[model samples]
Target: MHVFLPDGKQLDLPEHATALDAARAIGPRLAQDALAATANGVLTDLVTPLPEGAEISLITKKNPGQAQSVFRHSLAHTMSQAVGEYYGRKGFPKEAVKRGVGPSIENGFYQDFDLPEPLREEDLPDIEAIMREIIGRNLDITRADVGKAAALEQFSYDPYKVELISELPEGEPITFYTQGEYVDLCRGPHFPSTGKLPTAFKLTSTSGAYWRGNEKNPILQRIYGVAFASQKELDEYLERLEEAKKRDHRKLGREMELFTIDPLVGKGLPLWLPNGTVLREELTRFLREQQFQRGYQGVITPNIGNLELYKVSGHYQNYSDSNFSPITVDDEQYMLKPMNCPHHVRIYAAKPRSYRDLPVRLAEFGTVYRYEQSGELNGLTRVRGFTQDDAHIFCRPDQLKTEFLNVLDLTVLVLKTFGMNDVRFRVGTRDEGGDKYVGSDENWTAAEAQIIEAVSEVGLPYSIEPGDAAFYGPKLDFVVRDVIGREWQLGTIQVDYNLPERFDISYTGEDGQEHRPVMIHRAPFGSLERFVGILIEHYGGDFPLWLAPRQIAIIPIADRHNPYAEELRAELHAAGLRAEVDDSSNRMNAKVRQAELSKIPVMLIVGDKEQEERAVSVRERTPEGHKERKGVGFDDLKAELLERYQTRA
Candidate 1:
């Protein structure tokens, strides 16, 4: 059989030879380093027989996808064996520790087990020691295919494995990988042997998981671990984990008193405290001004609309699972708006439009609700109720690309304003043969092409993702990397022909005939709640002067200087700044510490000298330390604060 290499070189090999045999034929070094292989873009294990005339690319430590998955999967198998061995040594039979599925996920792997005795966090070290010992044995790992009857008999004692094997389609090969006495039923692309697996792994934690993520299914203990190619990488990841813990928005939000989730209010519904509300208002004002300057007219819509509106938009059919149940009002059903576009569409359909109103942009800071699962809800990033800085542009077909580019520019500006400089784009197009999409083929093709062309014209780095588009249209999502190197999807712009067609909305063209108007759906800040959550983590709870809820805290040295502190705060408030006076009878040093802990950006100290000079002593927070500039005139201080607020410095 002839097989092609990645470099276009062809070689003849035995008919049923595996990828490892192909690697050996190419070079000994490649065979030794090979972790997995990709044949015609499908990842496969080296032990799998290569197809005739296939295109093969050997995956080593250099490749991100297959190498990581292969090694991590192998580590999971090793960990499972270690667990069984540990139980066996403790007088329990090895068979008593039944293993469930173990799969390689991003950055690590996890395995589910049904053991006679439950595992605890304290047992992780002993398991690690056993894993290391198994690795030292350098046990050979091999795969084998078995028929249904043979597989069922082999795994009859393990109910999880039996259930999995029973569900396998007929005529499909059942495969299992074995290392020493530990065997797992998996269709795997795993490393050749235990010795080849990296030891730079640490079992992180244990949690309960249903066998197949179903609540009705039996619960299993899941052990989570992270593996890296080298010790240095592991160390770096651990350090980042520590930093992430400190920057967790949920923890920081409570400490800063920004937002809270109350049991009475229900899960996934966040109540913004006064401080968080200020942050929200400032962001809304900034975006509203930007939209106004760009010729967008603001609009308001009710929080609940008739169910028929969503039915026309196809959101009801596609997103009902994630949407709250309909409300029965006078025997007619209404739904809490899951999106703003449907309501905005009705506004466009309210009156007949003309070609001269070709690009009608309607903007809203609209709040919408969704029935997010409890497990998926985080502090504010994933919420039941949130606001979107949403807008929809109705334009002539000829203006599609231009309108898209304008939205793209606005999105870039929003990201930069938030100091999210590291940005990437993804153009989500429909799957070619998928039935889930609602629009016609021609409309899908045209909308996707326009998005790609607009992104190309902007000269932004982007990749195409199939099957990631919304049912109604293709979309361009802006993913930004935060300060801690975590990526979040913050902004999106989508083009739609389906909604306009479904609603039969049109404008009178110059030729005196009606024409369908294409719709461009965009949200620079996808959700105000999510955006604030990410911002909190991005800034590590230390916001910029303009965005800070409490921009300044004035501290008086003694009760005698309280009047001056109050006066300073009044001046700051008059300057359109959020300021507070520390009149709680606390010492100046304690006041400063409190301000620092609250992440207040600036602190002004007032004393007798400053009171006489009619100035304040400014102490500003910096990366290095508190910077103190003494005897700054009150006028100068106000001007500086105004400058930072205006320029967003």
Candidate 2:
């Protein structure tokens, strides 16, 4: 058989010749340095048998792709071996440990073990020592194929592995890798030997995970570790993780008194405090105003609906697990609305329309509910109930591109108003072979093409994501980056052709005939609840002047100046600014400190001298820290505050 190299060279070999064999045929030096090979673009172990007429490239430790996963996966096995040796030395018999699956993940790898006793933090160093010893032994990593029955018999003592093997379909290849005596059922590619394990790996943490991600499954102790090709990359990743920990929104929210999630109230439901609500309402109002100017008519929809609505929308069949189950009464079933499109469709059909009214844009801050697993819930980022700043536009087929452009513009304006730049678009479309999506190919193709053209016309950078589209149609999701370099999908604009056809929605055209109207679904702030959560982390809870619940807190120097502070506070409030006086007996410095910690954008000081001059001292929270004291006229300060508020600075 003939195999082709990436450089277009052809090599003739036997049917079962391995990549390592092919590399040796090419050159002795190539064979010496080859750690593995990329066969037809798929990574392969050095001992993996090559298919006839395959394209192959010999890969060394210097290659980063498969080498990383292979190295980390081997490290996991090595770590497991070390763990067993360490526990055995501590008088725990080798048979006392029952191992689960150990696999490499994005940044590192982890192994689940059913240990005789739970592991302690103090055991990590001992485990690491054993792992290093194994690495020093330079144990050869080899693979062996066994029949299903033989594999099951070999792993019968480990029930988890037995279960895994039993579930594999008949006639499927069964393979295992062995580094010395520690053999695990896994598919290749692995490093050449244990000696190839990078010195930059570290055992990070231990947690409990279900045997196979099912809550009802047995919980196994999971040990996590991170590995990289070099110490520099490992150090950089650790630093980024530390920075993310400090900027975690949940901690910042509590310190700022923004929002709270109570387990007693049930997991995944967030209660927005008064200040957090103010932030939400301000965002809503800002988007509403911007949307109104761009021809969006604000509307409201019910939070629950008859089950039939979702059935017609096809969400009932496709997303049953994510949504709340039905509530039945007198043979009628209702579901907590998980989306707003069906409700908006009824509104569109309420009145007869002509071609002049083809593009009917309806907007709403609609609340939605979904069942998020308890284990997956985090502070506001993942919640069961949240409000979506949703809108649906019904337009003619030819008008799809223009309507999409308009939605894109609105999304950009809304993002920019919150100081959220660095935005990109993801054009999500249907998978060619997927049965999960709705609509005819012609309509799907048209909708997807419209989005691509719109994005090009708008001159925005975007990526085409197959199978990432809505179940009903193609979409453009606007993603933004936060301060810590984390990316989030904030705004979205979708071109939907399935819903109108499903609901039989239509409008009278200029020719006085019925025609189907294309629909564009858009949400600038995907959800107020989630948007604020990202904002909390993005700004570190330091809201902008306009959005700050308490934009200015006036602190009196002493009790004698309380009346003056009250007068200044009332004056500021009368000027339509959010202001408060710190009337507590706490010291002025304490008040300033508390305000700063709460992330109030500005603090106004009222001293005897300032009162005498009919002025107030200002301290603004600058990126570098609090600004220097500057005294300005009370009215002058109000004017600047109003200017900033109006411009949303």
Best by lDDT: 1
Q: What is the lDDT of residue 622 in candidate 2?
A: 78
Per-residue C-alpha lDDT of model 1 across residues 1-649, encoded as one tens digit per residue? 8899988999899989889999999999989888788888888888999889999998875653447777898999999999999999999986799888899887899999999999999999999999999999999899999899999998888999999999999999999899999888888878888987889999999998888877678889999999988888889988888899999999999998899999899999899999899999999999988998989999999999999999999989999788899999999999999999998989999999999987999999998999876667889999999999999999999998888998999999999998999999999999878877897899998999999988888788899999999999999999999987888998999999999999999999999999999999999999999999999999998888999999999999999999888888888898898899988878889999999999999998889999999988889987677799999998888998999998888
lDDT of 2 at 411: 84
Candidate 2's TM-score reads 0.94
TM-score (all chains, Cα) for each model: 0.96, 0.94
List model 2 lDDT by residue over 209-298, tens digit each.
888878899999999999988999899889878877777889987877778988788788898888888888888889888888878898
**Model 1, runs deviating above 4 Å:** 27-30, 59-66
Each model's lDDT: 0.91, 0.87
